[model samples]
Target: MKKNLFIGALTLTAAPIFAQQAVQRPNIIFIMSDDHASQAISAYGHPLSKLAPTPNIDRIAKNGAQFWNNYCANSLSGPSRASILTGKHSHKNGYLANWNKEFDGSQQTLPKILQENGYETAIIGKWHLISEPTGFDHWMILDGQGDYNNPDFITDNDTVQYFGYVTDLITTFTKQWLQTRDRDRPFFLMMHHKAPHRNWVPAERHYNLYEETEFPVPENYFDEYEGRFAAKNQEMNIYRDMYEGHDLKMVTGIDSDTLLFDPWPDAFINTLTPYEKKRFFEAYRSRNNDYYNTDLTEKEIALWKLQRYLQDYLATIKSVDESVGQILDFLEQSGLDENTIVIYTSDQGFYTGEHGWFDKRFMYEESFQMPMVMQFKGEIKPGTQVHGLTQNIDFAPTFLDFCGIKIPEDMQGESFREMVVSGSTPEDWRQSLYYHYYEYPGIHSVRAHYGVKTDRYKLIYFYDEDIWELFDLENDPTEMKNIFGEEGKENITEELKKELSRLQKLYEVPGI
Candidate 1:
């Protein structure tokens, strides 16, 4: 084992309950999506929900506890997932960025510990760790980011290509696993979906969704990147970075005059049948024609692209929402609803036209915070909202705690199961969250920085530029102005710097 694989000093809580006859351990289902922002989900009640409503995803919140303050230690995909599996931050888990090397499968992981504790474990969907999964007794994962049409899944035996929308196929596999799983033993199933990621493509059925309706542009859609060096230098803006052929569904030769940069949709569009391709193109025919034919102002172009972006992005989520309904219905019908825990969350949050950006490499609020909702039928009361601080690292320990297994001493996160179950905040719960983003001088041109976020203030240090920024979140919720040198903030600035250092030391972030 890479670390302490068992609890040593911790007292045994509820005796290993899975071994009991009458009261078998509850089944665990963790459902995740890639780059799915909370703003897109209607349950959170953000502005985007006005047009793109997600009823099924909201059902999870309606029937269970919703974490209003959940944050991801790192905002990127691979790093966030690694943190969840290992119950540690990026620096400790060693998978700090999407481009980082394969995950160390030898490390002590949640699935391995669960399997050791007599639970059946499986992961079906996007597993971008780059290493073959070790702990899962059964795992069928996607190849790379995975294709929207006819995605390939690497299973225990072989890599098989499944022809269908990626979301439905993954959900189909999850339901299959649930149906065939041995009811005698409890199971841990990770139903991950690849939807609403970059180069957002909607299913054929939803291609024309929100086409007639125009989405309101973000107030700061034309952000001038005033004082922040990192914000001014990023390459993720909607007007410039979004690909002509890849993102907007406007083909270079047919739909526009510009050359394609990432032409992402081309990778799998050919896999579709001729009929499928014809219908797909037909759906975007009007939109493409209008863009190629019209000439608009600079801001009008940005607004035009934003409309195209939101339509496709939100439509992709429609299928994932439907998938949730399918699974929830399955559980309720199969009698598993009484003794199962179903969690709905994303790998991390992404930007949906916020700050005129598209990617999620920043420590800004849009990318820094993630959405989390769990439905444990008997345990969590419906509509219960948790305001306490939590992060992705808490996932592993919470799972272990729920199943009556001792959390390994090496895990950095504590179980919020009790805090959530009790439906109240604890007296001495976490006060501040520590965040670090290391992937800089790479994609999106975001600067390397780390910071500490309490309820009201955020102090960030852009180490590479030797620049510091302070945002009083209560007064400056938008984080538009940096108040580092402003008068009357010296005491708060010092306190925040001290808090940042304390968190770095507490979380054991590599360097002092």
Candidate 2:
């Protein structure tokens, strides 16, 4: 009888251990928003955030950690996404620009690593990097800069046009994949949204949101580019020179005599409504009257222009927020919420009249910082906040690490899993971040600049112009003043320059 009791006790002890071993591996869902600025999310505390509340994005912050200081390797879409995929910089991936570049999928990527480790991988929505997605077992991607409405999707089967909002279609595909994917194995899914980019057009449902509200102007909305040569030539300003080129098919309500030649064909005029038609003609007529014929006031035309721009831009963001909500709902209904890791971020930051600029590619805080948040459900403690410097390249390795997969030795990024899952902050953390913006004199008048941003100061070097711009971030957070050549700050500038040089050498930057 004593022998029987001993065997029964052993069986009881082993039961829980067996149950633990039977638990399934977690799912990973990564979502990306194009040109989404950190300031746009209420969780980040921008003054103008009340204009459009991102409750769904804030939901992730409430359920997980909101990374306060996350930045991108290169502040552009293709390069930043490439950095996240390959765990390398633009120089390594060889995709530095939006035009005529192809991404090589042979490189080690998080998805491929996960797939090798028994995880099923799928990607839907924008895959701007010029290559067939490699690591993914399944993928349905937009050709490039996907249309906001009735977007074209290249699936594993064929290229098909889906007649709906881009965000909705992408979310729908993600949900359908989740429903039909192999349930036995874990999965990694990327749902990338193409909304909120240029020519911001929302779905029919989000057309009139924030329509009655007037967005407050940013403090530096009228930046004069004083003390900074690079800022003087940016092509992102909305007022004076922010017209869409021939490629984008923009129909401004302004008159022909005062406007530059239309880059679009006459067929585009058919899309205008009777009221829109009246406004378009009046704008051109007013421009001709004010400048060429002398009739209407400049102030009237400026007000009209602001109204037209805001209507389209805010509408796009509304659709993005709605789509985020839909994905969250799917997670909850599928019983995958408790075991899934959800990440929401953007390729780069964008300007909404910040510094009177409307695009990214600058080291300025608005364009440099990106919105990043992650929710690992029960695995990570909710409402956690991390202030450590996180880069875009870190994403690939972090995902690999979470799945217990081996990160490729060629990947330069370090996993932030310790900081995220264990809440352990490292002592040897980086004191500064290195940034490089190569696209210059193309879209934004931003010059090619490389810089190092510390907690208190920022030093930027414009290589072609042989110019250095330094800002005491603690004193002048707005970056209005350049103190690189100022008296008494010479030592600080010199030290920062050395630090910058050290980082460039450490990163093996060739031209620096």
Candidate 3:
């Protein structure tokens, strides 16, 4: 009886220690959608949010924190992705633009740090960095600007082509990877999607979605680009740039693949299986027929193109939303939601007819800002809104902070984990953000420029054109007017310039 009593006492004493040992680092799943705009997301409260709601994506914001003013370090894909992974700007990371550049994967990245600290890391889906990913135990990424239908995935051993829509296929592969991953160690999965990018292609399930639906045109859809030399010189205008053959899936009457205006060749269309090709032609047949018949003015053509573009864009995003739901459901089923962090953001916010543009390159708010919503399961308070300035460069440090790993000294961004928990702006948070875009003499013709953005003002220096643009965001939220040399704003411009100089020095950017 005395031995039994002593054994019971020992078991009771070890219970708390055993429980403490069971506590593990939280798992993280970062979901990124290419060119997803905050304005298009239902959580941001844009007008179209009601027309096309993203309920699953909004659930993250509802359950955790919604960052209202999340901006990108550089408003380009490869640069932004590199910034997120390396916690540094393009100058430091060396992925300045999508054209003629490949990400140097040997450097210390977020995944590498996590993997070093006993975490299993994986990345699946659109990786536009042009180099094979490093530091991931398993990775499968799409080829450059991967095909929307039946995309080809570049895996470790083989470049396998998968059928079905790109978004759905990515989700399927992600779920499969999750099932087969080593269950002993914590995991960090990056589920990237290529939907809603240029030449938007909707899944067959959503091919005819938004038919006869008219999304309201942006207030600045017909912007004249007055007073802004860079804006006037840009080559991304929706009316002039979005080609029927390339963007709208409308083929020219000729069979020649090298037509002057055909942006996408017929060979790409042939990439679809026969059944998919039949469905694709059938879905767009009436629209193409109507487009050729309709006699419209340039303004009317622009509006027509905007409608078609948005319809396809929103339709493609619908699959992304569904995929979000699937992942969330899987987490709940696997009981991983109790101790995991889920994040949803985009490489960079896209321009959906804002300033009559379809692509993202400029440092304007529509292109410069990224939508970020994170749900840290039980850790974060529900329905929290973080209004402080945050950028993509902070992602790496924040993830490291969550995993209890020491962030590297060379990384430039600070962790926002405190902001997420407190549900309020930090008193010492950054007052301004720096932005740079480097791909000029390339697509869009947007001059390579760097800028600084404060809470109320923005200053952009078009270095290639030697032009400056300043906007009081409070007064001109749409940024329709350039207030650089305006009458009474000399002091504001000077103050912004001083701030810009300070940031350039702080970030160690060259030739400020």
lDDT for each of the candidates?
Answer: 0.86, 0.77, 0.88
For candidate 2, the lDDT comes to 0.77
The residue-by-residue lDDT of candidate 2 on 384-492, one tens digit each, is 8888888888898888787777778878778898888766568886788888888865666678888999878999999999999999988998899999989999899
**Pairs clashing in candidate 3?**
none
In model 1, how large is the Cα lDDT of residue 280? 78
Write one digit per residue (lDDT tens) for candidate 3, span 1-512. 99968876776587755334324688999999999998889999998767889999999999899999999998988899999999999999988888845899999999999998888899999889998999899999999878888788998899988877899999999999989987657889999999888778888888898867899899989889899998888899888887776776665643322223554654357677777777777787777667767888877888988998889899999999999999999998999888889999999998988899888988899899999999987779999999899999999999999989999999999899999989888899999999999998888898999999999999999987788999989989999999899899899999999999999999999766
Better of 2 and 3 by TM-score: 3
Poorest lDDT segment (10 consecutive residues) of candidate 3:
253-262
Give the lDDT ranking, best first.
3, 1, 2
How large is the C-alpha RMSD of every model relative to the true structure?
A: 6.1, 6.9, 4.7
TM-scores of the models, in the given order? 0.94, 0.86, 0.94
